[model samples]
Structure formats: C-alpha cells, structure tokens
Target: MIIINVLDNFQAALEAPRVLSLNSSKYFSGPYGEDIVFIANDWHTALLPCYLKSIYKSRGIYKNAKVAFCIHNIAYQGRHAFADFDLLNLPDEFRSSFDFIDGYTKPVKGRKINWMKAGILESDRVFTVSPHYAEELVSGEDRGVELDNIIRSTGITGIVNGMDNREWSPQTDRYIDVHYDATTVTEAKSLLKEALQAEVGLPVDRSIPLIGFIGRLEEQKGSDILVEAIVKFIDEDVQIIVLGTGKKIMEKQIEELEVTYPGKAIGVAKFNGPLAHKIIAGADFIVIPSRFEPCGLVQLHAMPYGTVPIVSSTGGLVDTVKEGYTGFHAGAFNVECETVDPDDVDKLATTVKRAIKTYGTQAMKEIIQNCMAQDFSWKGPAKLWEKALLSLEVAGNEPGIDGEEIAPLAKENVATP
Candidate 1:
C-alpha cells in the first residue's frame, strides 16, 4: 500500500509542477518532469514504468519521459499470487503483463504475477551490472531465471560497476591499521598479516600464505565449496580467515573449520567492516568463488590492495580478473542449479594451490604490481554510463555526442527507486 501511494505521489509530482510558498515573501517552483528518464531498479519499483505507460501516458502526462529498468540480480522478481493483482488497482488490460506460469514444477503450480517481467516488457531500455552478466542472462534460462526470451528481445546493456578509490585505497582506507601503496605493499602487508593473525587468534607467521574470504555464507557465494576446498589444505603451509554472516548450515561449516584446524584457519561468522579491511589488506590472496557474480566489488577492492584474487570464471569475474596476470581463475562451473558441484570445489582447490606456488617469488611481485597498476575507479565506468544514457537520447543517430555530452542532464533527471 505504501509503495502504491508513493507511486501515485510520484505520478502527481510529474504531472504538474509543485509550488512552495514561504510566508508571502518568497516562492519556489519544482520542475514538471520534462524529458525525464526514470530508472527503476529491481522489482520494488518495477510498477512505476508500467503505470507511466498505462495510466499517465494514456492521459497525455509524462509523454516525453522514458524509463530504464536496471536488473541487479534476476533471482528475485517479486512473485505473488495472481489474485493479489487486484490490490494494484491497475486496468484489466495490463493483467497479462504481470501474468507468469511456472512450468518447471511437477504439479504445475497456479498462475503468479511477476513485476520484473512487466518492467522488462514496458521499459525503454534494460541494463545489468556487467557485460558478462548481461550475456549470461540472455544465454539461457538457468542464469536468466526463466526470463531469457523477454530479456533477449528487449536487448540489455551492461556496464561494470566501479569502486570508490578514496575509501578502498590502501593508503586512504580508514578501517585497516597499516597503509601502503604498490611499492611499499610487501613490507606493509607483512606487518598487517602478522597483526591479523594475532587478532584472529591464528599463529602469527609472515612466511605462511594468508588467504581470505569475505561475503555472505550462502549457496550463491559458494561458501560450502570454499570450506570444502580449504579442508584440503588443512595440513599445508597456508593460513585462512573468513568473515561473513549467513545461512546457519554454512556458518556452522565455517565454525567447524576453525575448530578442526585451529592454527591454519579461523572463521568469524559476522560482518565486521574493520575486520574485512584488515583481511583484504593482510591476506596474500582473496578467494571469491561465487556461482554467478554480476560485477563483484570485492575483487576490485582486493586488487588495489596488492591481494591477488582466486575467482570462478563466470560473469564479472571473467571481465575483471585476468588469469595469471591479476589473479587466478578457478574455472567456470555450469550454474544450472544452486547445488554445490564437487568439480568446482576441486577446481578452486587447484587454483588455490597454484596461487600458493607463486607466493614469495619475483613473479608474485610482478602480478601484485600489475594488479595495483590497473584502475577500477568510477571515471571509466562513468563515461560508459554517459555513452549508454546518451545513446537513448539519439536512438538511431550515428556518432552521438562529443566528450562534452548531455551526461549531466541524464544524471540529473534519473529517478531510481
């Protein structure tokens, strides 16, 4: 009900300018949403585009406005009972837009309404976080979550997300104790690693290769696979630290690793921002074995800190992590389902071993230098976004705007919910 009311207020605001009066002395006027480009993110605000086309546009309101739908993750689509569609108070003609039938089930469940499907069909443009993720979404039903056909027809754009260099940089990070750039990373990391080992109750040894894992302990994050892989190196010269909070089973599995191998591993099943920074700064390598990543920020954060990443070669991981240059690829797995694959576990273990072999060598230093030298900041990605948004303004035109584009106008009018 609140969402519906908010949408109604949004439409009203767009339909006419609002006047603000100060005690008979001053007045302010809000813009009547002209040439505005609305950006609806995920399922929560999916109905905004539909309302614009069906109600407002039919009555000649916000006619020049365009809406772009951004899909951060396709797994959740705001599925609800078909009968609940009445609560939206939409026209009967728009019912088909939200209608969805789940054919994968054995008993063939009753009809449901999907908000994301409607947004995809109605929006002017569709976007995902990364290029590889965009391709994967249109490739098949497995990654697309049963919306591949619609996504393919609509044509989605992909732009890799960027990190805030100011906050994530080793020299400027406020969370970690020690700070260093590429040149001083080796000595600084040695000190951080020892400090981290003591903080996490592990034996402080600078020679041991410290590996870190930080993210939700969910099936999507491949936490089970990580635990399985780390178990293989219990008796080895490696040290592991994991920090995250999710799924009781996964949390228990991580705790078991700490109990089983006290010195080699420690798992803190909670979110600690400072601890996360320390782990990234201190660890020689960070493992991100996600089943599917739509432009992961952790690898971007890890690289600048001289921490090599060992990741699965799927989605944004493929785009960001260069094998043997910046990080090691753990091999891409067929993401047909959420079940953990034994092969993926083996592949990750092998990649970890490979990364361990490169440790403490001049080759390792070169890789670290390469990782640090690369830029994952917002400047490049911001330009790509500018190009994408401007392309919307000139749909069929060739060689759109110059460097000084209408990016500011596009940025100013974009309303996201």
Candidate 2:
C-alpha cells in the first residue's frame, strides 16, 4: 500500500536551479524487493533513475529483482529536451543508454532520448494493454516509430486490461436511477433511457436509440469522425449525447451541433464519472470509434451496464466487442491513413442503424445478454500479471523478498522524495 509521492510540485522541480532538489539521495536509500512495476511515462520517467540508483545501492538486497515495464500507449513516449537529461544525474557509463536518435525514418535527430524506450530496454519483461496493439507496435504499423525494432527483439507481451466490476455493475451502481442486470435490464434500460433523455433535455423517447459518446474529443479517439457522422445524420431518427471535453475546436463543433439539432443532441463538455455511469446505464449503444487504441476500458465499463458498444475494429475493441454478439464494430483504420473518411462514417452509421433497428428485437436482447455475460473484471488480468512476474528466473542465492521475509506495502512505509 506504499505510494511514493515523488516531487509533488512538478513545476517547482522543473524550475529548481540544482538537480539534487529531486532528492535522489533520500529515495535511493530504499531497498528493491522481488518485483517493481514501471507504469506510464509520468512515473516511469521520473522514478526510473531513483529506482536504478536504489538498485545499485541495495545490490546485495535485490540481486534478483524482477522488473516489468507496462506501456499504456507508445504514441506519446516521453521525449524531453536533450538538455534535460542532466536532471536525471545518471552516471557516465549509463548516460549513453538513455540517448536516443530518431533514425527509423529520414533525417536522424541529435541526442533525443525516449524514457519509455529506456524503460523497455531496462525491464526484465515488457507488456502493453492489448494483444492486438502489441502486434501492431511490432508490425511497424505506426512507422515502427519509437522502438518497434527493440520491442520485437526484446519480446513485448500483451495482456488485455480489466475494469473494476463492482464499480461498473448495473445492478449495484448508485449513479443510475434504477439498478438492473441482464435478466431485468430491458425494462430498467427503457426507464433509464427516458430519465436520461429528460435529464439531458432530449425528447424522452425510447424508440429512438440514444447513442452516447463519453471520451476525449480528439482525432485519436476519432472524435472528428464521430462529429462528422452525427452531423451527416442530423436529420435521422436518433439522439446524440456527448459526455466529454477535449480539443477546443471539436468542443465548439459539438456545441454547435447541439444547438443545430436542439432537443435531439446535447454535448455536456466535461468529464463527470457519475454522469458517465448514468450514460452507460441509460444509452442503448456506446460509441468508441478510436483511430488507435492500446486497450480501451470504457467499452468494458459500458458492457456491464447492458449497453452495447459500437467500436472501431482495432486494438482491445476488437478483442472485447464481437460483431453482432456482444456489440458491433465499424472500420479498422490503419496508421497510414491520415484521417478518418466518409467510408468510416458509412460503416459507423450502418452499425448504428443496425443497433437501432434491432431495438426491442430478440437479437438485441441476446446481444445485451451476451455483453452482460462478459467478465471484464481485473481478477483474471491480476492473475496473469502475477504469473508473468513468477515466470522470470531468479539469479541470486540472496534471500528473496517473499511474503515470509517482507511485510506488505503500507501507507506508513511510503517514502516522500
């Protein structure tokens, strides 16, 4: 349970005159146990050096520690300025290890290091959030841009991410007006649909399928494509409810769409977790037309609420949503494509229409049932992660920090650097 809060003031740390203000001296004294998990760039980039220093300090204590570096997304690999490398205070021998050059394509840049790449190179095991995404990275889909070659050689595994089932359960969720599961979800859904429509000031109609979009308003999430499709189908018999805010231009466009379609469309420009749960419980279909996704958790959260997800056929969306079974999928856009086009819109609209037509039909009910039957809970993934860690070979005779030797991490033991 120990949560190290390192450099609480990020801006202050950045503006500090000296590098030692990061307090590596105090944090490096701690001992490394049998396992260490490097999360995304924020923590991994900042704490990696401290962890490395600590490992070097406690060489006797952690001779055979296993490290796992989890890549949530490789698109935004931590690429700080070359001058900032001095802040890491790494020794001369290891300094060049972090030094990276952009040479996969044309015109090699001088001395730019990717922290994510460094983590991948350093870790005992590497993993991403989904199997398909892991494949994509190694396949050079996105130019193999960041460390695809290294990743392929080093072996990166994919373990689909899971959600907190208890928090997303439709039968137990407190955010929704009514609680129901697969068996009684139909009636509950109808009631919640009307409630949601009235709450958002839509026409309170159950016949028209209410399509909900609750993610970032960015091209990567295919917000542009979604907005285009909705605008194209403004006159169609459906309601659009957007529950997220990003990209000022897209937000403005969404608000404009809301105004143009008055009661039929509404864009609540913010991230409200409870509202998201309510939207999931109330909407007939949740749309996630991401251009690229490592492993999306929103669709997983939506499924337990008996909400059918209409996703782009890529990454975890493909792994989770079975066509016409749990839900439906549209086009699978590749990295070579500059932008999502009308063809993508056609695919999206076709599935949306299918979902609408199937409303109240036996097929729709079965689909909802199938979605609810799915187990996207974290239990399986936790076991898989544990198995991955245990598979690693221990090299030293030094005493391992198993349950018998070391106490569990507690809040009291959290070191503040």
Candidate 3:
C-alpha cells in the first residue's frame, strides 16, 4: 500500500511558492519491493483529501496492501475525534463560528489515538512529514506514555517535506520578470520589478524595495511578532506583501492594515497557489518570523529567488537560514513571547532595514543570489522515507503493536477572520 499524507496540504500550501502535487503515490512511490503507508497533515480538517488520495493510490498500485493515516497534529490542542468525510474545505475566516467549536468542542485532541490506532494496526509502517514532527508523536508533550507504547507496538518515522524543483527553479520562472541563475542580477532586478509589482498587486516601482511575507497567522510561525513588526514598519517606504489567513486576532489586524495601507499592502486571504510563487520570486526580502518553525519551506523557497529571509531563530528556520548568508535570524521567542518585550520590534525593523540595505547594494545582492542557487527539492527528503517505506523493518519486525486508543471527543477546526 502506497500512502501519501497531505492533510490540508493544498490550503497549508495555498500561499506556498508553488502548488504541491496532491497526487500522492507519484510523489512518493515505492521502488520495487517497497509498499507505502498513509498519513494526513491535519486530522481535524484536511483529512479527507489525503484519505481520498490513499484510496485512489490503493486501487491503482497496491490494491491488496492496507492503507491508513497517522493523524497529523492530533495533539495540536489536546486529543479529539475526527468525523468521517470531514475533508471538504470549509471556510472559518468569514465568521466567528469556528471559535465556539474549537474552544468548547475540543475537536483536534479527540482524534489523537484514533489516527495512530488506525496507522499502527493497518499500516506496515507509519510515516510523518518531518523528523521533528515524528519526534513530537514519539515523545511530544501529549503523546508521552502513548508514544512509547506505540513504539513498543507500532512503527513510525518522519520524512522531511519535499519541494518540486521544476516549480521552484530560478533558472526558468515565469513569475520573475527576469530569469537568472547565480550570475545574473541585472535582468533579475528588472524581472523583480515588473513581475513582483504585478504579482503583489502593487505598482511596478523599481526604485522601492518590495518586501514579502507568507504563512499561517499564528504564534507558531511568530505570526504575532510578524504582525507587530508590520504594524511598526507600516509607515516605511518599503512595499509590503502578505499571503495566507489564520486566527481571528491576527487576521483582523491584517485586514485592517490592508485597508489602512491600501496599495502599499497587498493581501490574498484565500487559497492562492501561483500568486505565492510570484511573490516569493519577485520580492527583495522574505520574512519568516517564526516562534517555532519545525521545518519551513518558505525560507527555502525564499532563498532560490534571491529573496533574503529575516527569520526568528528556532527549529527549521535556524537549520536552513544561515546568518548573513541566506538570511538573518533573531534569537528565541516563545508562544507567550515575554522575551520579545518592546526592544524586539526595533530589532526586527533593524533586520528588515539591513536586509534591504543588503539587497540595494550590488555586492550584497550578488551574495544573496549565490545562496539561492543551492537546491532544496524532494530528492533528499523523498529518499529518507523511500528507504524507510521500502525497507519496512523497524527493530527487525514488520507488524508493530498497538497502543491504547483515546476515546473520541469533539475536535477543533481552525480558520482566520
């Protein structure tokens, strides 16, 4: 059974640089002797699309193999049970409807064990998207006891998410007005001007630096800090571009800022794929002010396009964005964010100014262009899972044991206002 867990991938990747292949087995195929297992990225909401994909893959290739999903983020809030066929994309931003449902209903936590229960019992092996995410399931805050039991019984592994080089390549991107590799800044700048301005819905002004931001509007990615930073820098000469929608407090502020900033601030609060790539390719600088980024693709995407990133030091951002090389990093800030205090905003603004200064200078831009040329596609990530899935031996056994399954409760469904 070949399974690809893409829970809510299209929406999670809505504002990502390119549209990820929803067609799972093709992206994650077993070489010859290997069979695939299934999982979802989000359990509460995006489960159905992935489930459908697994069903499709099973029918075509591994008809006899049992395919199932390792519920993604089952412990996101707490344990919650997921309803059958809750896969259709639902809008939670327009109204405050999802609120009473999330806090009171407690949906996400309900599906924790059920998701794993299904994965371990049915799948030869369970796979996650990232090593970090895998760790969470193994030894996460909520999964402490259950994770161990699952390990004693069920086998699980983390596979770093992959990117399509075809879509992300700088050598040939229609999104950028100028197509250049590491050695062609002159045309890139021209391309940056026309392509970015048009892409972001801003006027094509080569004179000003175009700034870009794309991600979920939650504290996990330092969404709160980013909101503050934007508000702080709204009066500056730079053109700001934002994508994606999440959380009421953050989303409302962004909308208000859009009204306040007008043409200077461009935002698309829906699932838009192509526009995100254009923004990433066209922008002078990309921002990933994450509070705790497990493994971020945006910063990776940002670099290839000569888009210097300004990220918070944590998780994947720290691993990918080297200071003064691909991007700049500010130190630790948690969910509560007491460490960020008032001085944090100044530092963020300073970082942006510095990155802009770096972009404006001919020598610095060349340095940035050099960094972006490096590859970060699916080849490496796919191989890790490819080996795991094809091997199918954890502790020299194929069938892993089952742990205690949690009682299904109401789950949480999230969206932006």
Of models 1 and 2, which has the larger TM-score? 1
| lDDT at residue 70 of model 2 (Cα atoms) | 79
Name the candidate, 1 or 3, with the larger lDDT value: 1
| Candidate 1 lDDT tens digits, 318-413 | 899999999999888757445778898899898899899999999999999999998997778877876777667733223323332222222111
lDDT per residue (tens digit) for residues 1-417 in model 3: 112444445334321212343433432332322133333344333233233334434456333333333443433422333442233233322112112122324445333223333334434456555565455555542332244445445756655555555556677654444577767755675566677687556778876778778888766656567667776676777888777777777777666656777778776665556667777777777787765555677877767777788877655566667787677876645434434555556667777777666656766676576667666776666556546654643232243223322224223211111
Per-candidate Cα lDDT values, in order, are 0.81, 0.71, 0.56
Residues 1-417 of candidate 2 have per-residue lDDT tens digits of 112343344323322322323334432433333334323232245435334444343565344444567777777676655565666545545555567777443223466756676677766778888888888779873634557887897898888987766667888776877998777988899999999999888998888888888888877788778877776665768898887777898888777766888988898877676777778889998989787888898899889888999899887888888998999888686443356677887777776777777877899899999999999976677677666766775542232222221223332210000
Order of candidates by TM-score, top first?
1, 2, 3
Error of 1 at 53 (Å): 1.4
Ranking by lDDT: 1, 2, 3
Candidate 3 off by > 4 Å: 1-78, 81-114, 117-127, 132-158, 174-177, 198-204, 218-222, 234-237, 247-249, 258-264, 336-347, 394-417
In candidate 2 the C-alpha lDDT for residue 380 amounts to: 72
Tell me the TM-score of each prediction against the true structure: 0.88, 0.81, 0.62
Q: Tell me the number of clashing residue pairs for each predicted model.
A: 0, 1, 23
Give RMSD (Å) of candidate 3 vs. truth: 12.1
